[model samples]
Target: MAQKSFTASVNAFRDKTKAQMRDVFSEAVQDVIETAQQPKARGGRMPVDTGNLRNSLASGLNGSFGAPSAGGYIVTLSQLEIGDIAQFAWTAPYARRMELGFFGTDSLGRTYEQPGNHFVGAAAAQWPQFVAKWAARVK
Candidate 1:
């Protein structure tokens, strides 16, 4: 029987895997940015308008699968400020009051409870789907 070796084939697979992993991470980051930019009510009961907030969303990727050692890639999603003002209204001090509501009632004497926006939670929930998509694409 002729002796056979897979060293060359294994090396090729490793290189392809590394390249595909980078593509997967890049696509994942873009997905996160797009999700964050979606128009949705924020700032709880106050319901901060999307306005410039959606435009402020951005994504960044750091490191790569081919890096030395065991270092891995990192994807970061950020809300950048527009001009000197913060784009996200949730960063304002009054955001908390809007989320938790107040004890006082309006002129009609009818009170109401403010609700939290839950934007962060909602975004986190999509992470699993994003990861699955990445895995499928890489394979």
Candidate 2:
């Protein structure tokens, strides 16, 4: 085959594989959100408040933050590539406080002595399994 033809074929294959990986990653992120949102009986610790925090959970390519979704995070990671980083984020203002614990006064000058649930961390602990499960589904 011509060099140009060979290169084009290889490039197409690479793109397809990358897309598949992105799909796998996206699914894995969705799994994390679902796990974190589960009820306490199911081993999840996040309490359902106004539900904003849960709805705001989103996944993006190398993004540490995202605008809170009006509905809920759709778990779309289309732009991720082989070398790109995938990030899971909660856009709510109190997300970090809830996850990591807050025992002192906040910037808003409110007092809080809440213990940490680390719900997201608990959910993310299974990241390797999630990724493996998603990857196995890729064709």
Best by lDDT: 2
Mark the 10 consecutive residues where model 1 has the least summed lDDT: 64-73
* Steric collisions counted per model: 0, 0
Candidate 2: segments with Cα more than 4 A from true spot: 2-9, 39-43, 56-66, 70-72, 75-88, 104-113
lDDT of 2 by residue, 52-104 (tens): 87777766566554555632456345455567776667778888988899898
lDDT of each: 0.45, 0.76
lDDT of 2: 0.76
- What residue runs in model 1 are displaced by over 4 Å at the alpha carbon? 1-5, 41-50, 58-114
Candidate 1's TM-score: 0.48
List RMSD in Å for every model shown: 11.4, 3.7
